[model samples]
Target chain A: MSKVTTAANQFAARRGFNQIANRLFTGIVWLIGICTIVFICGLLFLILKKGLPELDWSFLYGLPSEMEEGGGIGPLIFNSFYVLVISLVISIPLGMAAGIYLAEFAPATKFIAFIRICVEGLASVPSIIFGLFGIALFVEALDIGLTIIGGAVSLAFLNLPVLTRVTEESIKAVPKELKHASFALGSTHLQTIRRVLIPVALNGIITGICLTAGRAFGESAVIILTAGVSSSGEMWDFSLYSPGATLAVHLWYVQSEAIVPDAQLIAEKSAAVLVFVVLLINIVFRVPLWLNERKTR
Target chain B: MQSVASQTLIDIHKLNLYYGQFHALKDVTMDIPEKAITAFIGPSGCGKSTLLRTLNRMNDMIPGTRIEGKVAIGGADIYSKEVDVETLRKKVGMVFQQPNPFPKSIYDNIAYGPRLHGIRGKQKLDEIVETSLRSAALWDEVKDYLKRSALSFSGGQQQRLCIARAIAVNPDILLMDEATSALDPISTLKIEELAQELKDKYTIVMVTHNMHQAARVSNQTVFFLNGEVVEFAETEKLFSNPRDQRTEDYISGRFG
Candidate 1:
């Protein structure tokens, strides 16, 4: 009877072990799912709590008065848009071409492999280093001074490595059969890329661009060094010689060092507005992909 | 059928292809009659697909591939020194086994071939898109939403769209490499029917593992084994009474 009881207990132990393992598996899945939802909610709640109350058209468009008077971030906003656009114009084509070479045309060789390693290294280097390089090359050597061109050029370098990697990955994600189909239809290599490959990968590439743009827009350390702190409240400027202070730099300057009576309010308002604008830009950029996903479904 | 009988579409002579040191195709020779179906049936790696790809110079795009042969469409040697591969391909279109429609709208996928050859006007493009879709037997199901993404279609419809894309350029010959292999039986039947309808206007050469498919669609059948032609005869004759025992073994499913 004792031996029979031992066998029965062992069977029960085995069943208990399976039950515990199964419960653990399901618990982990639920934990991940719940954590993701909670994190997203936390982000949205914090941004809204700090940002929504301060936003107004007057605050966005009004010119800055003296240090004591409450002023707007109009000049900083204009400068941010200008620098972001110019930087994109410079970096996008070059990075995309490099990606195409690496993905489509590059032979499997040690030299090509070395170049890929270098690009990966470039992506990991800190933004401060890029800022220093820009100051040395564009600001001092090129005699560009502290201006928008120097800052835009710096941002372009910062964006290139990331954009190139993204472009290559997106292009690679396109099925091989699509290229073969295009070729069999008598389209040349260039034609196939333009008509088939690019269109298919457009969503992924655009997402990469949006992320890069966000980085450039919010960067403080890089822009403060390359572009001067001085900003004029003009919305339109074609010349690249003007001094510009983007919104991020403005928030940093006001909060840390400005001795004005309204500096505290300005910091709070600027932080709020800045967060809102960034969120707005990200949502606007992602709208196309969201609609596309729905249509495909 | 009336206009097709007068034109000699494709003439291949003494063809050989190699991948590095491995010989893929061995001295293949054949004449593809105009606007008729010629099917290549063989075991796997018998070089049927390789020979089919050579007709449109699709092999040129592959790396480390070499060919020693003559493939001419409309009496122009496609592999000659002065010949342009792009133009040659334009005249000899191809459809693949997997349904490979462009990641674009149904209309844009069909219109891509004609657009590249400088068919710019929207009205002319619309006409070509419609006619091509109709020829491929996909127009009625897809006519309402030409702007919809091509990937939204079923597997069979997507294969038909590929055929429409190929034919929209008005090529002299169409090459299909197991074009219906990835599709279901009903889809395969529709595509085969489309192939029959297309032969009245375009010459077609197909490579298929399915002997029944080749028998049902092709007027002529070329049997190959171990990179050599075992027998070449009318489709009925080749299936009913194969001269080569190797061909008999392959058709009987002894071994691939």
Candidate 2:
């Protein structure tokens, strides 16, 4: 009876060890997942706490004035939209075409592999370096003054590598069967891409575009060096040659001790607008994904 | 006794297909008759699907693959430099083993091929979609929800939609590669019936592993083994009185 009891105790101890180990493994994974969610929500809460109260028609629509306490981000907002649209116009087609080449058209070879590595490396390069490049080429060499076009072109170069990678990934995510099915029906490769591949990957592409737009909208270093400090007179001017200040640059400029008397107010208001615009763009981007989910189900 | 040009719609003469260095198809030679369901039955990896794809020059899509023999459709060598691959494909359509309907509205799925082939205007496309769906035996089930996405359909309906899409272009030949092998018995029978009806207007070259399905739907059957055609004859004769012992063994369920 004593021998039997000793064996049972040993078995129980072993089982207990395994149970603890299994629980610990599961607990660690769960902790990681919860922490990620908590971190994201915490960051958003912090930004909103500091930024949301500054949202008002006066702060949003009123023109900037030296005497005014909370003038407006109207010019900055307009400039941001302008720069974003232009940059996307330059980047989307070129990046998407390059992405298509990499994902679908590039023949497997050493040169193609080298080009792919370069693209990945370019994506990791600093944004400030892009600003420097822009100042050197567009501002100095090209003699394009500190204008919206110059800023937009700079941002396009910065965003192209990321945009192309995302587009390629999304395009590649579409099942090969879909392309094969289209080809079997006699569609040319170009036709298949135009009709089936693009439409199917539209959500992913739009998501990438929104992310790029958000990055462009919040960009400070590139806009500061390339586009300059302020718009030329009119807030609603549609001219690309005019100097522009995007939301992020406006925040940075206002937060600085120089020039702005109401630095805190200006920073808070600009930050609020920036948060709102980013969220809005993201929501708009997700609409296609929602529709796709509904359609597939 | 008849010349291949007169009776056959798709003529394959010494058709050799090589995938890189490995010979995938070895001197495959056969003729597919016009307006008939011709089934290619063989063990897996016997180049049955390869032969079906060759009729429409679909093997051109694969890289590093080359063909050493000629495949002619309607007396024109499809491999010729003068051949317009797009036009040839429009004339000869295909349906795959898995049901692959475009992730679009049921109407759009049917009208896509026709629209690409230059049929414009909503009314014409609507008519074509409706008629093609009807021909594929899917009209009654899908008439009310033409605007709904095709993914909502059952597997069988999706396959039928694919068939409708293939036929919408008004192709002279329809190539089906084990199209209904994924469907249930009831769905398989329905597709077989649709195949029978389609043969009146189009030539069908189907590949199937099911001996019963081959016997039931096809008029002519070609038996393939080890990348070569073992026996070719009328479907009934091939099943009941196969000249090749390999064909007999396969048909009798001895082994593939």
Candidate 3:
């Protein structure tokens, strides 16, 4: 009877220990989740608190005045959008074609493997290196002399590897049975890709485009080297050969070397706008995916 | 029980297939008749599905796959230099074991093949979608929800939708590669019933693991073993009195 009582006591103790351990794990998981939420919230709060007061309409639309106290980011904003459009126009078709070739047509030869490795390596290379290369090739060799086209081309190079990888992965993820069904229905390879593959992988392709757009919007190094630190005098000057400064590059210039007295305020407001636009781009892309999920349900 | 009125549509003359070093199909020669259901039965890795894929050259997509001898459809050599593979495939449509509808609206899913073949008018697409869905017996279920995604349908409905997608192209042949294996019993029965009706308009070939399914739905059954055709006979005769000892043993549940 004494031995039975001892055994029962041990079992109860083990059960209590398991309960404590489970509770500890649960607490740790919750703590990690809460920490991430708090960190993001804190960063957003800091940016808004410092930037909201200075973000007036004039500061957004009026031209930047070097000698004046209050200067606007109109040219910077226009140039940012200009450079983004140019880069996306150059990258999307070329990247998607390369991606399709890699995913569908490229054989399993050693040469193909080598190309894949090179693509991955290029993806990991720093943006700064691409910026330097852009200066050498577009600004110096091509004699473009800090033109918007030069900057845009450099940004396209930076976005290409990422877009290609995303496209290949998304295309590869499409079910092989779908391809088989298309081929069985007397569709050629090109027709099948155009009708079935592209539509199915459209979500991933959009995500890739959004990601590259966001990166190009916030990039400073490539723009500074290839597009220069000043825009044309006109607010909406869209000449490809004109010097341009994107928003991120303008922010850096305002913080480091602006002649205006309210440079710090301008920088803070620019940072806030940058963060907000990126967030908006993410939400815009996610809407379609969310609707797709809801409709299937 | 062999039907005398059926005419030969596909003739295989000493066909051999290889996947790199592996001899997947050997000396496979048979005459598949038109406007009838011909079922291929075998154990796993028995080359039944491979032969079905060969009917439409679907195996051409796989790397390192090689074929020898000849396959003729309606007295035309399919592998000849003059024959375009795309046109040949248009003559032969296929359904997979898993229902693989494009992730699109129900109407778009059926209209994909028609559109690829360059049918563009709104009125024409609408008519084709309606008729094809009706042919697959899924019109009433999905008629109101034509704008909804095809994936929203139940598994059985999706399989039928896939059939509708295939039939929209008006192919002369339909190949089903174990098309009902992933479905429930009710869905399987529904597909089997649909196959029976489809054979009146198109030549039907199916690969099935279930012996009873072969016996129940197929008019002619081909039994395959070790990448070779072991027996080819009428479904009734093959099941009741299999000529080969291997066919008899396999049908009697002796061995695969």
Candidate of highest lDDT: 3
Each model's number of backbone clashes?
Answer: 0, 0, 0
Q: Note the residue pairs that clash in candidate 2.
A: none
DockQ of each: 0.51, 0.51, 0.62
Q: By DockQ thresholds, what CAPRI class is model 1?
A: medium
Residue pairs in candidate 1 whose N, alpha carbon or C atoms collide under 3 angstroms: none
Q: What is the lDDT ranking, best to worst?
A: 3, 2, 1
TM-scores for all candidates: the values are: 0.90, 0.92, 0.95
Q: Residue pairs in steric clash, candidate 3?
A: none
Error of 3 at B5 (Å): 3.2
Poorest lDDT segment (10 consecutive residues) of candidate 3 chain A? A6-15
Reference-based TM-score, model 3: 0.95
Model 1 vs truth, CA RMSD? 3.9
Residue lDDT tens for model 3, A61-99: 889888788888898889998999899999999899999
| lDDT for position A279 in model 3 | 80
Candidate 2 CAPRI category:
medium
Interface RMSD of each: 1.9, 1.7, 2.1
Model 3 native-contact share: 0.74
Model 3: how far residue B131 lies from native, Å: 2.2
lDDT by residue (tens digit), candidate 2, A1-297: 577755554445455788899989999999999999999988878787887875778677767765546667788888888998899899999999998888889988999999988999999898999999989987889887899999999999999998898888888999887887888777888889989888888778888888888888888999999998776746788888899778788788777733656778788767877887889988977887898767754
